[model samples]
Every structure is written in C-alpha cells, then in structure tokens.
Target: MASPPPPTSSAPTGFSLRKIAIPAFGPSLLFGIGEGAILPIVPLTARDLGASVSMAALMVALISIGSLLNNIPASLITMRWGERWAIVVAGIWSGLGMSLCVLTSHLGLFATGCLMVGMSQAVYNLARQSYMTEAVPITYRARALSTLGGVMRIGMFIGPFLAAAAVHAFGLQAAYVIGIIGVLGAAVVGARIPDLPVPPHPAGQDAPATPTLVSTLRDHRRVFLTIGVGVVLVSAVRASRQAVIPLWAEHLALAPAVASLIYGLAGGIDMLVFYPAGKVMDYKGRRWVAVPSMLIMGVAMLLMPLTTGFATLLMAALAIGFGNGIGSGMIMTLGADHSPRHGRAHFLGVWRLMSDIGSSSGPALLSLLAASLSLALGIAATGLIALVAAAVLASSIPTRRTGAGGAHEK
Candidate 1:
C-alpha cells in the first residue's frame, strides 16, 4: 500500500511518455483488434477448415504451446536486444504467423499456422512484459502493465462483436483480414518504439550477461515456484469459467450471440476497472487487496451455478472481474517485489511462464471435466480449487527477513 519508491535511475534514453507509451500501446491495441476478430470465428473457422471438435480445440491449444516456448526466451531477448527491437521483431513474427492462418485451407496446415501464431504470441508477450519492466520506472511498472491490460480487454470487448459482424457480412475471410491488419498495426507500433539500454552487467564481463540468467533463476527456485503455482491456479480457474459459461448460457437458452454478449460484459467490467485497480495496487501492498479479492473470486464461482438468468451471470462476471483485476495486478507487483535486484528479468520470465501454462491449460481441463461430470459438477470442482488457491495465497505472504525492502523488514 505504500507508494512505489521513486525511480532510482532515469528511463532509458529519456524518451518522453508519449514516445514510449504510444509504441507500447500500439501492440496492445492491435492484439485487441485481432483477438476481437478471432474470438467469434474460432469454432466455426475450425469446423470449416475441416478440424474435428477436438482438433478445433487444438487450434486454441497450439497458441499456449507457442507461449510455453517463448516464455523464457522473451525475457532473455529483452535483456540482450533491448526492449524495442525485441518487441518489434516479435510483433513482425506474430503478424506473419497469424496471417498465415488465412492462407491455409487444409486442416493440418491450419493447425500448423495456428501453432506459428502461438509461438509469435509467446515472443511478443515476453518482449512486451520485459520491455515494460526494463524500459519504464519500477514505480510505474504495475500501472503501465495495467493500462496495457485494459487496452487488450477493450480490444476483447470489441473484437468478438466486430469479428462476428464481419463474418456475418462477408464470411470468415473478413475476420482474418481484420486480424492481419490488427497485427500489422501492432508491428508498426513496436517498430516505432525506441530501444532501451541493456541492464548493467557484472564488471568486466563485456558480453551481455546471460550466465546470471541461469544462476539467478536457479537460486530463486522457491519464489518462482510459488509464483508459478499461483499463476496456474488462477489461470486454470479463469479458463474454466470462460469455457463453461457459454454452455451455461446455452442451458439457459440464450442465443449464441447473446451468450457471447453476456461474457463480453464481464470483460468490459474487467477493462473498466483495470487502470484504477492497478493504481490501487500501487497505493496498497499486494496482499492488502489480493488475498481478499481472490477469496471473493472463489466465492463468486461457488455461487455460479445458483443462477439461471443473464442478470445473475452479469453479477458473477462483475464480481469475478473485480476480484481478478486486483489479484492479477497484485501478483505482478509481487513478482517485481520478489525479484532479486539484478534478476528481475529472469524472475519475470519464470513468472510469465507460469501464467502462460495456467491460461493455456485451464480451459481444456475444464472442458474435458464438464463433458464427463456435467458443467455444474466440473465448475464446482473449479470452485473448490479456487478456494484452496485463495487459502494458499492468503497464508503465503512471506514474512520479511532483516534488511528487506520497505516495511516488511523487521
């Protein structure tokens, strides 16, 4: 809850906020647009492209696989290449890969194309996170990330509706066209972002230091594991809810469009609160809100099956949004707080990998469970998992050692 300590060092290259912010903003915006365009069409696209339901699901899964590959590399690249170049290069790769999805008509080829996109996303996300962490002041790191997250959610809000409209009007091709443009827009922004100086290396070790990357990661095993487990728990629950909500909507007999729209409102609330929620995290310590927020999220999920109307769904979404918004920002700040003075990139790389794994796996696991046990039972299990994860988070706030930064120190 303390204000962030002021910037110890100046921003790299002393770029004005405008110069840096716009560049960062561009990738997020384009990602939103592309994401928006893809969401409505993903299932239909898969079927049309000749994928089985399971294979179609794999199309989504492939992206997670790519994220898995890039999680650590993204951090490594930003440490060496400078944030701007790494992000731009990653954006270009992302654009090219997503565009490839449009060109392929074969199911096998389409799946491969999707895999490329996933990989590109991995690199792009890592570059983006590392870049923000390295290029900006530490005090603003969570805020900055929060702002971008807001932008992405906004894109999500619009992307699906727009993509759906595009598909309705011009068929599936329009969605890809828009996606290509969105990615290109992201590339442009990344391209314009100027590079920051590499983190200082140990004396006389002229090559940009990566030996430390390995060692730093190895030494902080517990911190990273804790972060990883937290990320996986949250992401899986988040994904499970998203996967089942539509089915829930269908059970209540809402039209497909109506179902998506219902989910969209939650995303909208999520976007709306993100900036202020992040500022709150900045103003308050991570646990002041994060611990309680997560428990509430679990409670929200526990109540999910109790409602059958859109209004109830909306309430669930709003509560979940609030809880998650605070939780994510806090966790991110926690990652920063815990990273060794010289090992932030390494720590963050691991932290992000945990998120990718969680986000990637959560939905699939839920979907499978739902098929066997029914949606309510599956969600109930998720709710229980949420309760356990929340309890873990609430209890896991580490007591500070002597000389710890800020108030945690004795």
Candidate 2:
C-alpha cells in the first residue's frame, strides 16, 4: 500500500462534532465504569475464593493477559463486523463475563469471567478509536479523542464510589452486579450509534485491495520500531504510577483512608487536564505535550522514594497525576496520525498491543525488582525508564508544526 499523503490544510471549517458526541463517546463511559468497578474487587474476590496472595495477583494479571492475546483478533473482528457492531458485541460479551463473576463461586470460573471481560475491553476500545479516527476532522481530532479519554476517566472515577455504595448495601458480589449493569447499559447505548458511512471510490476507478494484518505490520515496521518503543515506555510509566503511590503510602505507614484520599486527589487532577492536553497536541504538535509530560512523571517517580511524610508523598503523587493528565489521548492520537487508510484497524491493533505489553510489563517489572531488591530501587528504575521514554519521544515524534486546520509544515 502507498504511504499516506503529507498532512493537509483541507479540513472543513466549522466542522462541529456535536452531532456525533453521544454515539461516539457514551458507550465508552459506561464500559469504563463497569470495568473500573470490577477492577478493585477482582483480587478481593480471588482471595475470598481461597486463592493465596500470589495467586490472587495472578488472577488480576489475567485481565491484561486476556487483553494482550486478543488485540489482533479484535482487529479482525472489527474489520469484519464494523466498529459499531463490534462495540455492541463487545459490551454484550463483557456483560456475560460480569454475570459469570456474579453467579460463580468457583475460582477457575471467576478467572474465566475476568479474562472474558478483558478480551471484550480490547474489542470495545479499538472499535471506538477506529470509529472516531474516521468520523472526526483532523483539526479537531485531538480534542475529540482527549474528551473521550476524559469521559472514561470520569466514569472510572465514579465507578469505585458506586461500587463502594453497592458493597455497603449488599455484599462483595454486588460490585460485579454493577459491572453487569454497566456493560449491558453500554450495549444498549452502542446499539443506538448510527452506522459510519463508507468512503466512496471515484467513478470508473478500480478499488485498492484492503491490506491484511501481516501486510499492515510489514509496511509500518519503521514507525512501529521507532515511535512504538516510545509508546511502550510511556505505557509502562503510566501503569507504574498506579503501583508506586500506594506502595509508598504503605511504606510510610500512612493510614488507609489517608492513602485513598491522596490517590483520589491524584486521579481528580489527572481527569482535569485531558482537554487542555489535547489542545496543546493539536495546536503545538505532539512533542510539546508528550516530552514534558513524561519528564514530569519521571522526575516525580525519582522523588517518590525520598518522601517520608504524607504531605511529601501527596505532592509526588499529584505531580505524577498532572504529568499523566497532560498526556491524555496521546497514544491514540499518534496511532491515528500514522495509520494507513486502507488497513487502519490492523495497524491500531498492533499499536494497542504494544501499549498493552507495556502496561502488563510495568507492574511485573515493579514486582520483580521490589521482590528481589527493594521497593525504592524498583520505583527508581521505573523513573529511569520514564526518562528514557521522554528522550525517545523527543527524537521520534515529527518536528513538523500544526497550522490552521491541522496542516503540517516542517
């Protein structure tokens, strides 16, 4: 397949996205909430089922494993069924998974349900991103995708609170019930999305053959190897941020309630920066946000081990949050920018795979280092990785500036 043309200044003026907002982003919010509600309880459920601490950790890891294994297949499914239907199917599948979690007491069955939900998430996320890449104009792409990210954050932020309420009212299993409701609601919302129009060919012109996954990967290997490495490290840092704050809070002997409040505040900060981050990426080019975001997170991670008090730890956690917040939607925006028109889904699958690998690996690396050495060393190493990611991004991202209507000019 031919390379994509240089970025153009032809995006239509006043191309408002208000019409497609709900259909584009609504299901994601519901899905995020459901997934978030269940995430905090998965390990607890495993322990209740008689699994050891290590085994319970493994059970939580299964979700990432499931997502990693399904990325390519999810793309194939999206290609065959289209994005809207793919989302609907994924949501239904997630609902089924949640039902299993709610009904089953067996450990193996519960693990299967977790795996299924993760697999469904892979499909649901890819389909939504693919849909938006095509539906939104390039000039507004960053804002659109960033808002989508923010929406998911909002849902996730709301989810745990809802789960807590439900757990207080009912029992532990009530969280999974909430998940079932959320996924089913997402499915209902997904069903309402209007079908995306297929781009028409010019009269009397032969249509180009659609690229397969293998061909897509082969063609995009350069970008994958370069910016892709940066993507992996970026995901690694983001994932490690989740682990570092809690571990440090524990290390400092902070109260559980205090730790939760600090983490919650960090999440709130993270949620607030998505729109501004997108604006920077769209108007100033990706590097302006990507490089500095990683740098801040990297510095925060390096400083975390030195904190002996709650106040200090809280500051570090918030720094990490602010850094990560400003990088919202960056990975998806990069994927959208580089994807070929003919096999976009296939390319995005590879992109998401790299991201998932980093997400899964980050926590594992932390566990290994913390177990073998010390927690401080592990966090410091993660900080080093984040710094490396920043350097990689600085060198790899295009230096072109985005002008009016998203035009790229060197």
Collision count for each candidate, in order:
4, 0
Runs of candidate 2 with Cα error greater than 4 angstroms are 1-5, 403-409
- lDDT tens digits, residue span 18-121, model 2: 77778888887898889889988999999999999998988888888889999999999999999989999999999898888778899999999989998998
Name the weakest run of 10 consecutive residues (lDDT summed) in model 2: 1-10
lDDT of 2 at 272: 95
Off by over 4 Å in 1: 1-20, 199-209, 255-258, 328-331, 340-344, 397-410
Q: In terms of lDDT, which candidate is strongest?
A: 2
Give the number of colliding residue pairs in candidate 2.
0
Candidate 2, residue 390: CA error in Å?
0.9
State how far residue 81 of model 1 sits from its true place (Å). 2.6
Model 2, 114: alpha-carbon shift in Å?
A: 0.6
- For this target, which candidate reaches the highest TM-score against the unseen true structure? 2
- Give candidates' CA RMSD values in order: 4.4, 1.6
Model 2: per-residue Cα lDDT at residue 118: 87
